[model samples]
Target: MELLNQFYANEKVKQTLVNFITDGRLPHAVLLEGEPGVGKNHFARLIAASSLCSGEKKPCGQCRNCRLVLQDTHPDVMLLSPDGADKPYSVHALRELILSCYVLPNDGDQKFYILRNVHEMSEQAQNTLLKIIEEPPPHVFFILTCQNHARILPTILSRVVTLTLWPCPVEICAQALKERNPDTDEEECLRLAKQSGGNIGRALSVLQDEHLSRIVKNAQEAAQLICDGKEFELLCLLNGYNRQKDDFLLFLGELRQIFVEALRQKYGASDKNFLPGAMLNRISALQTMRILDIIDKVSGEAAQNVSISLSGAHLCSALQQTLRG
Candidate 1:
């Protein structure tokens, strides 16, 4: 259970899962829902390992089954995902997987299928999976991970046990980061933990990726510029991403997170400062809400293959107008 112990926060969910494993009452179909970096995939793997472990303590980590699962070489544990960049599970692939479910396990009495980001499956593909999930073979288990469960069909959802993962406290997350990267500076780890709002995966990404770190830094600067009503500076900053749609999307996501923190602070719901106290004083809750709306609209447009230059310009103009109002 080393992996489970390392999974930060969500004590209740972890206990429930431990109970299910101990009682041999683990469900046939499970859906893990959470935003990116919340550890849904890691949780899914934990369930898979726990179910397939041959050792006394479930998921002993050193057991043969546990080792195989950790290495992603388990014969009975299959990892499935969408076909391509568009990230849609094809009906043909779903059919093949469904057919394989009836086959006996390769190494153990039970088999597990870990489906990553199942929310990407199209309606047709989902319907094709419905029958198998509704009445899966006794030896087969389906573990699905998704950022949002709302995109899944209600019928499919009805057949599965849904578990949601959440961010841990900042101190816990920072400590985890420190443990994972002992050579890194403690102050840097805490800064990343705060920036990511206690999401370990996100903080780790920023710590490891210089480009991503730069994006976050730029987004913070943009937020400050918006609060200062420096339209020209903000526009110049945004125009730097005129040809980088992917980077622009990431920038918008980080920008949106700052506004969300701002909104939370305005309502006295959060004390973690994403912006300076002076900047927060300059913007009202209503203005933060409007900026969030603008970011959402621009983000959607940017995702739809809109020209990055135009989207950047729109974001700058809309943010300035909202702040002025």
Candidate 2:
């Protein structure tokens, strides 16, 4: 429980995990699934620490095992992630990981393989992983994290214990932000909490990184333009990113999130204050869906190393046509 104390919200998940760990019934293969900023990585680490901690209270935070895991220096904990800009795990690398599963733990009775973003793995790479996870060595455990479970193979899903994480309430997230950053004003913290839809990691990034803040601002502005059906203005605004492909991609991601929030609001989900109520009211659910589709297309083109200027033009025209139609 102490290990998970820092992880806010999700009381049920915390208690469920606590019971499993206390009863020594923790699954050998665990899958943590959630949105990008929902703390899947944090939860994964907590589980790892709890399993390997030497002290009586699992993950006492003072024991050598716990400290090592916190510092990412634990010999028994291997953190794996996809490689390259496209973020695909190499089938060859995964095969090597499978081969290493049989090796005994170096520092403890058990070893943990923490694989981040397994959803990004190609089907071939996942199949390679399935070979080991299906019948992993008794001394080895696999902890996988992903933003989407739909991308994972059914066989993999059937083999792991899946836990889904969601954002905390806006007030709870704001209070957390205030506690972590005492120097920041309460109003600013609340604003960030609302803008990020209670996602602490997302709000914290905007607070700490000026570039990300700018990207977020640009994205919100773009969403407003889309709602207002301002094709020319939207084009002019997006044209500013012609030379900054990375920033443009980030903007697209933020824009997609805004539209998703708007769509949810249209369907009676509680507003996280991602946008002004007036703006949200202006866009219908169908229009939001169309915009999301267009954004996905543009994002795909951007990922393929397409010219940012060209993508921006296409996005503007497509959105305008969809909105008018």
Candidate 3:
């Protein structure tokens, strides 16, 4: 596939890879770790394309090599992602890759193997390929991608150069969305970009969430109702959200954003900035800080998934108190 235009944020990484390839000293094994959809796969493919391209500019993007890679038919290029990254890679798959590593490349310049979502490899699978990784064939190169670097085995981690990828800035993401879907409003796409928390995959995911629309709607209503001291209505909405335990924390996060935006407006931040308009000037700054503190606490606990039993009610009450103050 053509590298997504959204990958512009990763130009440094692409250049780094390009430099290494041009110098002919690129490591045999590499680990690409990042938030999902920040273009780990694209970076890997670009590097793979650069390695395979026989053109003067390497990845001239118009060569026979580039065309074959885009078609997923590069003779010396191999992709060995987990059967499903949401699941585990099998011992059989790892063994196959290991065996394939020993074979000479078909055209014989270099071999590129991409193992996407290496974190999903089972212990046995990781162990199966350790020997091959330890003594890789001279021309063989591996690119492993993962969302959670911690899930990968230390042995594997130690063996590869770990490349970290982060989400692109909102303006960049918005620019990209505008390029692909010209009809989409830039401001609206920026909102989605912020909600994505630095993951393009997540930004796209946010676009598809009916639940998010409801969550945003409910949070907006709760903010207005809380400001009006509509305790009963607020409690009803919170209680309804509390049932969908998995979504509660994210819901709280949205509430926190709205409240924080209101506070920013109180401090004279403008609408062009992301702060909510100054209608909430009555709420004190300290109250906003306290609600934010509670959000941080709840968000931390929620991330560990250990605090699921903790009621969002307490956080809601703190936000209510913040509004009331």
Pick by TM-score: which candidate is best?
Answer: 1
Q: Residue 317 deviation, candidate 2, in Å?
A: 2.5
Quote the lDDT for 76 in model 1. 92
Clashing pairs in 1: none
Q: Please, what are the lDDT tens digits per residue for candidate 3 over residues 1-325?
A: 2343326576667667767878978889888998666878877877788777777776767788777776778888877666655333677756776887888989856899888887777778888777788889898998889988898888988898888887776677666666766787888788866555335665665666778767866767776776666766776787775446568776777777677666655676523344333446545777667767877876776676644545555656766676665
Q: TM-scores for all candidates?
A: 0.93, 0.93, 0.69
What tens-digit string does per-residue lDDT give for candidate 2 at 1-325?
5768878998888887889889998899999999988898888888889988889988788899999998889999999888655443788777778888889999878999999999988898899899888999999999999999999999999999999998888898999899999999999999889888889989988999999999998898898899899988999999899878888899999999888878877787865766788898877788889989999999999988899999999999998888888
lDDT of 1 by residue, 154-215 (tens): 99999999999987777888899999999998998888888888888999999999999999
The full ranking of all candidates by TM-score, starting with the best, is 1, 2, 3
Q: Which stretches of candidate 3 lie over 4 Å from their true place?
A: 1-6, 83-88, 208-235, 238-325
**Distance from true location, Cα of 234 in model 1, Å:** 0.6
Local distance difference test, per candidate?
0.89, 0.88, 0.72
Q: Kindly provide the TM-score of model 2 when superposed on the true structure, using C-alpha atoms.
A: 0.93
* C-alpha root-mean-square deviation, candidate 2: 2.3
